[model samples]
Target: MFKNHPKGLAVLFFTEMWERFGFYTMIAIFVYYLQENFKWDQATVTNIYGIFMAGVYFTPILGGWIADNVLGYGKTIIFGAIVMGIGYAIMAIPTDNSYLVFAGLFVIAIGNGMFKANISVLVGNLYGHSEISLKDAGYNIFYMGINVGAFYAPFAAAGIKSFLMNNFGATLAQGYNAGFGIASIGMIFSLIIFTAFRKYYQQADYQSKKEVKVEKDVVLTKQQEKERIIALLTVFGIVIFFWMAFHQNGAALSLFARDYTHQFVGKFTYLLFDVVSLHAILFAIFGLAALLKKSNSSKIKSFGGIFTLAGLSLLIYKISSLPESGKISPEQFQAFNPMFIVLITPIIINYFSKLNKKGKEPSSPAKIGIGMLITAIAYVIMIIASLGLAPVYTLNGSTSAITVSPFYLIGTYFTLTIAELHLSPMGLSFVSKVAPPKMKGLLMGGWFGATATGNYLAGFVGRFYQEWELWQFFLILIVCAALASLMVVFTLKKLKSATS
Candidate 1:
């Protein structure tokens, strides 16, 4: 599966892995830190969350322009990483001042905007126009690297906070800062790896738009460029709803895990919350699949056997070491989405690859529509789970303190991860595949621009968490996702033809 790709893919993969580790680490603790540090209500916290996420995505427009026009993708990425590291350091200062927290988030947002879109553009730059199928597959591989970091981030946050608070008798605020400090170190590692591997991806790193060429400067006509941009903008506008719903993982969903969902678990059920165990399971599954395949390559089979044994050994080791029962953390529940991404991305890619071989693969837009429908299905689980739960606000104007099984949030995240694998990576691939070469960076940023809108909307929607019944709030998301899916279904043909 890793065969015959540009060496740059690996370079960018690991670079993104560490950067995302830091970002997700911060995200896993963001709202909790706010609530604990400042005593902000849900509305205020959600609004801030929405704005911060929006800024994180929105700044990419300028970041992409900077890469295209000034510093180049490589320099921009490095600069962004450094800025993010500084921002994380600022957040880790172990102070009680709230403005410093906002200031740190602002800096991180600026840096992420510079970093995110350009690296993705670099990924697309690695492939030729004729390699669209291979390009999509490559993005899936790259996306998995991102999730590997994300999968570890929550655990890292949990472990870091626990260690600081328990071992050093640190306060809660200090523990949160310690996690942010680890996030800062993650950025440093990202910078070192990406800088060291510069040779591998140097060819793709154009210092300016004049140097950019995909397939020997094949230029788009005015009409073609217009149509493609229109199509991409259409898709981007629709997926805003998807992000609005999916990002709830950080806002309403996190709160649900903290307040509305049961956190205690048995040894077996605790597997979901334990990153080490989940990581072992991923290795074992991959190994078992490889070993079962009728591969002619002895090397592949041997590698598979070794991985299988090692993974199972690790799992056994973990099982013996963990407590029989314990309370899981809310931040830990956020890891499920990334864990699913790591485990399932290959399957999704392989499935599409099979369909491609038979000339039956859905167009990117169609798959996106399917993903939106799935997003709706994901929330249906939440709606059901909320059926017996207390209303967020009641007739007496008092909120209930009821909780449900953690499985609801887990299941919701799992289902949403499926939607994300389809919508998000495919969205990035769509932008990379469809955008005109000259406008690649701008339009790529536009994708994030749309995400900025969606993420802001996520926090906006999160505000209603305190206003409506829990089920009603989720139902709003379901309606939005379903409507977005319908829009795609209606526009699928036009979208496909434009991209084609």
Candidate 2:
């Protein structure tokens, strides 16, 4: 999978993996921390969670601008990582003060904004226009790095918190704080990896320290620019609903896990997962070495392949060994989507590759539309599973404490992960491929801005969870996702025409 791509992709991949580890780690515990530690009500927790995530997505506009016009992509990313690391460090302070928590989140959001869009632009810059077909595959690989971190973050948080409580005799709040501290450490690792390997990505942007000089040189006619903008905006608008449906994992879904799901995994399963972490690190190192290797030795190349297969086989063995009757936590269930991402990415890429060879690959916009429709189906599954479940919260926003089967969430996450595979990475690649060259950074930021809008809507929709039945809430998401999918379908031909 890493073959034929620029070596810099490996650097970006690992860097993003660690960065997402920090982000998802903090996010996995955030809502629970608010309720358990700060004693905030559901409304408050969901509200803050939505707003914080919105800010995180919203700031990329500024970050992208800075990278494009000021510091360039590399510097902006490094700077963003440092600032976010500081924010994570502050969040680790274990305070009851909501102000302090929000302050920390704000800083992290700002830093993420600066880093997110520019790094993607850098990846897109790595290949020539002729490699556009490969761009989607590249982004999918990059997207896998994100899921790899996401896949482990909840586990890490759960493990760390358990360790602190069992061994150190710390309170749950303190353990959560310690978990946040570890998240900070993850960001530090990301920064270190990027800074140490900065030289590898120099050619991605035509020089390590320089910005793209094509902003003014490669001018487009008015009609071409307008059509490009329209196509981007169309995708942006359609994807808003997709994100609104998708990001529920952090808010509404998190609540479902806390209140509805049966969470009681056995000790053996937990232990196996813990053991897998060591292998995760070892595999990452071996993979990195393989990607970075300049040698042509067949034996050396085979070593990386062997390590990859060994790691994956071990992972499958551990998962299959888990007792079916054993329950796990809601947060632990967060791992399922990313795990699916890691498992399914190669299949999706191969499917698309075959389609490309046959000249029958769906256009990026069509794939995104299909993704939205798939997301709607995911919610539909949840609605059906939630049929008999009662509301966990009263109309007046009080807890009722009724729970549902873990399979409800597990099945939902599995379905939605497939949707994410179709939409999220495709959206990134589409932006990289279709956005006007001179405005790539800004337009990429626009994609996130749409996500920001969707995140805000996600929070808005989350507010309904407190007042509505679980099925009703999910039904509403079905409507939203279906509507988005329809919108994309309506524009599919025009979007394809414009991009083609």
Candidate 3:
């Protein structure tokens, strides 16, 4: 999977993996921390989530500009990581002051702004224009690195909380504090890795001023530049609704897990709830991948068999250790999307590769449009889950006794993960391929800017979780996603031409 890519790709991949570990750990607990410790209502908590997430994604504009004109990509990433560490440390301090926590989040966003866009731009810069055929695949691989960290994050956060509560008689608030501390450590690891391997990806750290000198042959006429920018903006505008629908995972979907979805289940039927159970499945998956690969040497297949045996043994041990039933955390449900992304990325990449080989691959813009359609389909599952449930406002903050099965959410997340693979990475690849070199950073920020708008809307819409029926809220998302998909159909030819 790593073959043919630059060595720097591996460096950036690990660095990003650790960075996402930190960010997602915070995400896993951010809402619960607010509601449990600060005693905030769901509306307020989700709104605040929107603000923090919006800022985190939106700041890339400044970060990208700084990288392009001043600090360059490498320096901005380093600076951002340090600032993020400080922010997490502040969040780790034990306190009743909500303002302080809010301040910490703001700081995290500032640092994230400087870090996020530049790193993505750096990844895009690794491939020259002649290698456009490989660019989408490259971004797909990078996206997997992000999900690998994300896949483990909720488990890490939950494990830390469970350990502290069991051993130290810690409060949930204390568990949250400790979890935030772990996030800081993750950031530190990211900073160290990036700094140590700085030279490998140094080639991607192009300053805007150097565009004329570095790649002078790929000149864009003023008219061509205008058309390309317009094409990108069109894509950005349509994708806003897709993100607005997708980011509901952190807010409305999370609430559904806690209040509306069944949390307790029969023995071994709840692997998503237990780390050991999850690990058994993870190990078995890797073992099978290695063993099933036709190209693997016999020696490698032997190791794969060993791993599979170990995983089976562990699974048996885990089942014996479990009681009849256990309650699951809402945060753990968030892991489903990322884990699915990690598991299925190789398949999606291979699928696209086959399509490309057959001369029938969808244009990047077309893939994004299909993603929007799939997002609508995902919400349809939610609409089904809501079919018999009472409205949340009527429940008065109590967990529903007639909760639907966890499969509803698991299915939704599985479908949404597929949508994410189709849209998010493709969008990044599209921007990198189309954006004029001089404006790469800024245009990349524009993509996140659209995401910022969508994230805020996710928060904004989350407030209506009570005001509207569950199906009503989901239907709204379906409408938005479908409309965006329709928009893409109308503009497909123009986008493909511009990107080409």
**Cα-based lDDT for every prediction:** 0.88, 0.82, 0.89
Worst 10 residues of 3 by lDDT: 209-218
List where candidate 1 sits over 4 angstroms from the true fold: 214-217, 394-401
Winner by TM-score between candidate 2 and candidate 1: 1
Number of the top lDDT candidate: 3
Q: Which pairs of residues have clashing backbones in candidate 1?
A: none
lDDT of 2 by residue, 215-328 (tens): 312345789879889989989989999889899999998877766665565544453235374455457556546745776477777777777777767766766766654545
| Candidate 3: residue 112 Cα off by (Å) | 0.4
TM-score of 1: 0.96
- The residue-by-residue lDDT of candidate 1 on 382-498, one tens digit each, is 999999887665524223466788888888998999999888888898898788777778889999999999999999989998798888999999999999999999999889987
Runs of candidate 3 with Cα error greater than 4 angstroms are 212-217
**Clash number for candidate 3:** 0
Candidate 1: residue 412 Cα off by (Å): 0.8
TM-score for each candidate, following the candidate numbering: 0.96, 0.89, 0.97
Candidates 2 and 3, the one with greater TM-score = 3
Cα RMSD (Å) between model 1 and the true structure?
A: 1.9
Candidate 2 versus the native: TM-score? Answer: 0.89
Give the clash total for candidate 2. Answer: 4
